[model samples]
Target: MNTSDLKTKIQNLYQDILINLDIEKIDDYFAENYVQETDHDTLNLNEFKDHLQKLKDVVKSLSIEKFNDMLIDEQQRSIFLRYDVAVEKVDNSMGNIEVYAIFKFNEVGKVISCRELSKAYHEELEGLANI
Candidate 1:
């Protein structure tokens, strides 16, 4: 819809869903028809939930290390964002990943699609990132 609304949604996604490990809240941010394309694989809404579950199981903490970019297209309700992610694994090992993602939103403002690329430069993150 609007840039501010989109920004709020993105912030909530990281703070309330990913950082909090609240899988149930995902529906609030993502559409039922959600699909994500990643370098490795494609995931539907159900698969995305499973992926989050796996992350919840293995990740002790998650934080945004750096926010590189966020560009929104108001006409299309789409955005391109790049950020660095820092995570503490269940084993207490630390890792960092750089992620670039494109997200498309539905009329009601739920995320309908996402295509993402992520890479870990450090060994500590390589294994944890697979989940």
Candidate 2:
């Protein structure tokens, strides 16, 4: 696939799948053997799916507030994205976080591996309990 198409696929993975909580479409964007690494842990495809489901359950709403940067390396078949997220949970807790994510794509354009770092800031809202 071309670089443009690969970029679009990554965008859709964030916009359509992650933000929209479209768990069923996970396989469409991620390779069957995809691996993901976060600051806390590493996960295979199935584990990643389960993680997304748990996130969906906890986060009532999520939005990509800004794309700070996006860099694509065709030779390396990798994409790096830095963005800010606005999150509101079911318990009325809210936060703004910045995330840096790197995606390595397979030859067919499906994401084969990913790594992410999230910088989260928490501010207690008056009378709002975090669950």
Best by lDDT: 1
Candidate 2 per-residue lDDT over residues 1-131, each given as its tens digit: 66797788888888877689799999889999999888646889998888888787778988886678999988889999999878888898898777789999989888999898777766632211111
Name the lDDT value of residue 61 in candidate 2. 87
lDDT of 1 by residue, 26-86 (tens): 9999999999887668899998899889998888999885569999998999989999888
> Which candidate number has the best TM-score?
1
Cα displacement (Å) at residue 110, model 1: 0.2
lDDT of 2: 0.80
Q: Could you tell me how far off, in angstroms, the CA of residue 37 lies in candidate 1 after the best superposition?
A: 1.3
Candidate 2 accuracy as TM-score:
0.89
- RMSD to the true structure for each prediction, in A, is 1.3, 4.0
